[model samples]
Target: MSTTPSDASRPSLIRWPERLGYGVGDTACCLFWAIVSSYLNLFYTDVFGLAPAALAWLLLITRIWDAAFDPVVGMIADRTSTRWGKFRPWILWSIVPFMVAEIALFTTPHLGPTGKLVYAYITYSVVMLIYSAINVPYGALLGVITDDSAERTTLASYRFIGAFVGNFIVQGILLYLVQALGRGNNRLGYTLAVTILACGSGLLLFYVFLSTNERIQPPQAENSVRRDLRDLLGNRPWLVLFAMGAISLVYLTLRQVASVYYVTYYMGDRGLIPAFLLAGTAFSILGAMLAPWMARRVGCKKRTFILLTLWAAACNAATALAGPRDLVLIFGTQMLGSMPLAAIFPLMGSMFADTADYGELKFGRRATGLIFAGSTFSQKTGGAIGAAIVNLVLSSVGYVANAKQSASVLGGLRHLMGTLPAAGGLLVAGLALFYEIDTKREREIGAAIAARVRSVAAGRPSDS
Candidate 1:
């Protein structure tokens, strides 16, 4: 394990108000994101009139853009100096564009098929770019809000609760809202519903800007981008987490996209889509709520993360046995699977913060924004890979839009929804074991970084 000078002082405890303030941003983000990630594939195929092959390419292309884009945003944010702080300023600046891009994503324009595809490409690309601008900073802000590992866990839980709330609302009410708003026109309903959600998302982000503060300050000396990139490359913990987050996202994206198809076709009850989404996410909240306590009991975040993820994998794999007629059993298994998944994001996020501290301790500089940016990139990349796989699998199985699926199609859907996610879960669990940062090591990094900050502020050289 690495070592640095010990500091007696620890970061102050975060208040509930500030914690809630930080959480609301994710709620707003998810309002846009949950809809796009969970429902976009459906919208593209069913309403937007895109072929599965086209949608697959679209997902891959956009995520490739994110691969380059997210890291640049992170690097810029790190080099940024502002009265509002490095991360918080972007949150304030990007809100309008973010909202506009979201609205554009759900808007249905009457155009030729090629025109519509072009519009989809432009709008979706803009939305993701804007998302990186806003959300990359938002995630990096978690590191500055507080340095306490335990407190970060608590904050992550609250953040995910807010995320779950957004998911619940979207899954439970969005379609109904669209139905009510559109009356007979699906296009109009989607537009109006997303418009309302976009406005709400913006307001919540404003609250985050107003309510949170950046407490942990980065180093005063400006480092070259090359140096920062070099540091990032050497960050072992961050690399482990980056890989883990990517794999985790693969499962999450696949399962969420597949659930819509599974309900619409196999279950033959599109009405139950919202209910199914609601139950799974709601149970996930319970899992997230329990994460801090579980971490404490296990004596490390890695253990808690690994155990919960594997449990979710088991639950997801069990769904393979449930046929179309096993409605109650299917839903029950989904709820059970979601419980462990609920904690996964929060736990992993807290762990990432640890990795950030580790990077600082080892590299003699801090790059919170860059680290989380890498994480965000991994997630988007994972989503891209997963989405492509699902769409291609659907096409290969002869899944026709708005028609009864053949047995091959049903089998493909089952594997996509069940086996794939379970495999991802196991992969996450396995990769986590390679992560070196634990609670004790995290606390040590914090202390060392704190001492280094003090030394720099006092015009003394840093020991690292």
Candidate 2:
């Protein structure tokens, strides 16, 4: 927790390789994330033979546990003082556990329904716990890597490009690999697939640790846990981000997970899954590349986000208008819908960094770990709630696993994939109106924080 005066002066200090390294770390992380968010429920219900309602409970309970546990991890990370830095050390230490938990999560054991459910709970919980350990610190790393708001946005764009590439691999290549490698055994395919993904993710994380540096170090005197929590709670921008994280993730999760069902059941072609996902991921990559430019043009991140969100909503609605037999229309809408969303992740990450700046500017202390950990809580909670809601809706509509879906169930799948998520996107757009951190204001805040840091470093009283 020590930063030099040099670190304070240069806002856009990160080099291209460093930025590339940072983005690669997220690409690695998103491998597991893309698989779980896009396919875990389907894996449980279809491949693992768990009931939809039971699976719902498992997702809900585990995510609630994640929300509660994230802050403790955050607090520990903030207090951590390592040669490598506070946040990077966690990434170093937690990779093994994260790898182990991931493999266990996708491995199906030979057990009765009861035993299977127990196994799901055990494996998923461990994976999530380890996930929080690594990812919370990873998110916090963004703030410390560079205090430059514009550079952070650029870095976020790179990060989501990595994310889309990871998703493309998982979404486009994974199922086919599973089918090919498993031959006929889905369980085997999942186990082998996840093993490869987990191993690759570990290597990428190692690279992140080696290639990146944390520049925004904390003061030697740490804030008390209570004080940190108070500052976090009082941070208006962070609060907006927290709520936005959950709400938007719910929309994202439902739309992503439901697409599997939509293609498989409604379209009656399991082979199309890879193609559909690849199309969306490709378009998403384009969107990620375009985000910064779009935001600059629109005059602020919030406004650009709103425009993109509304565009996404329209794309989703268009998907709903296409019938089950309309393969071309479905694919077209999926690609179009996903394009704008590609911008959202990078924009959100950049904005979360802004909230950290806001917290420091307003509260006189920086708790990057705590603030980002709360964001992790919001994400897991939203994902869990969204998954649970999808499962419940599927169950209510008489969705029988591995059987031909009824018309009613097909309708439900379409709504889950399209209409509901579209509405959620609109809600996210509306909520963005309340968040007041524009690019101009962000620079103003960043400069002030830099001045405060310099004052404190020189043994003078900081006016903050």
Candidate 3:
């Protein structure tokens, strides 16, 4: 275990620059995420003309690998030692490889369908694996950054503001960037755009390495993966978050991955894709900014998350009735849907961090990396299921790329945005109801952990 004098004291205010810089890392992570979440399925579809079923298999398999791999990475990260700290060092180590893999994932190789399918598996796996290596640790960084529960929530807000900024950059500009850079070659445009953005993402991660410090650690230097797993499974708050994370993402991914096809095919305007996505991104930023205030005002992060999740889903469901030319209805629902969707992320982050505290206080052990990684596992699994559902629906509906669709096919797209998300949203809200930690409980946990860490620090003077 490691603890500075400051670590012995919970609620120490982190300076603005460091907090901002830490948040900036999420911006980079989210930038890449925007690409994958928003466009990867489209890329796979157009790249080789694979059946949507094949593409669904591709997404499902790769994401399954990605989800399962998070816990292993988290375990490794928990045991890691370095001058830079356990989590930040992973960012430094993985950033370059991550960029390389990102570019590879976007590059379109000339090949037959079978060859292309194989290539997709290889490249997607590499990119997703590299992403897990960096991202799991980065999420874990929140738990170690500060012990202050309120400050942790505040920092989570800033982190997601950076996230929405990343989404803004990609949503508002990537298509235009691809067009301008491609000179009318869609393949070339994606390659060039991804390459440019990959470099920027790498630089932002490097800034995180330079700007952040790890201040809190467990009371023991020893680690037990079995214990970590056992503790995680037994932790009620973690279990609720785990379920909520999965179902919420299943809903979110279905809509996000469906949006491109919906806009181009159902809405009858390809140009509307960028605008539609941007409206969601812009409002997501508003949601992220409002989350902390709302949580405080609502008297608990858990309650705020429930309200936002339900509202977001209802808004998404309402979009089902919109006609092809109902621009107001479509965009209005998008803005309404995205705001609450965005707000939930920071609250989720804070709640997960609180769960880590809850585990240590209860179990006499700490593994921040493993706990956050479990959260990631839930989210990635949900996203995989959601994406798989989208692909299966498209395949079943006789969707032909860049072609006019039947009424039923268009109806399928509308139901994806509406019906599927509503069910998932209700499940997520219901799961959230079981989350026991309020702001009051979170503070009590933090203070108790601090006192124990202080006792351990006194016994081991060298740690101070």
Which candidate number would show the highest lDDT if scored against the true structure?
A: 3
Q: Write the residue-wise lDDT of candidate 1 on 244-339 in tens digits.
A: 988998998888888999988888888889988999988988887888888899998888889999998998898887899898889998999998
Model 2: weakest 10-residue lDDT segment is 1-10
List per-prediction Cα lDDT, in the order shown: 0.86, 0.88, 0.88
lDDT for position 427 in model 1:
86
True-structure RMSD for candidate 3: 2.4
| TM-score (C-alpha, index-matched) for candidate 1 | 0.96
User: RMSD of candidate 1 to the true fold?
Assistant: 2.3
lDDT, candidate 1, equals 0.86
Candidate no. 2 TM-score = 0.97
Clashing pairs in 1: none
TM-score of each: 0.96, 0.97, 0.96
User: 290-339 in candidate 2: lDDT tens per residue?
Assistant: 98888888878988888998999998888778888898889998888888
Per-residue CA lDDT of model 3 for 289-390, tens digit only, reads 998999989998998999998898789778988888898999999999999999999999988989988988888888899999999999999999999999
Off by over 4 Å in 1: 1-10, 454-460
Better of 2 and 3 by TM-score: 2
CA displacement after TM-score superposition, residue 329 of candidate 1 (Å): 2.1
lDDT of 3: 0.88
Poorest lDDT segment (10 consecutive residues) of candidate 1? 1-10
The 10-residue segment of model 3 with minimum total lDDT is: 1-10
Kindly report which residue pairs in candidate 2 clash with one another. Answer: none
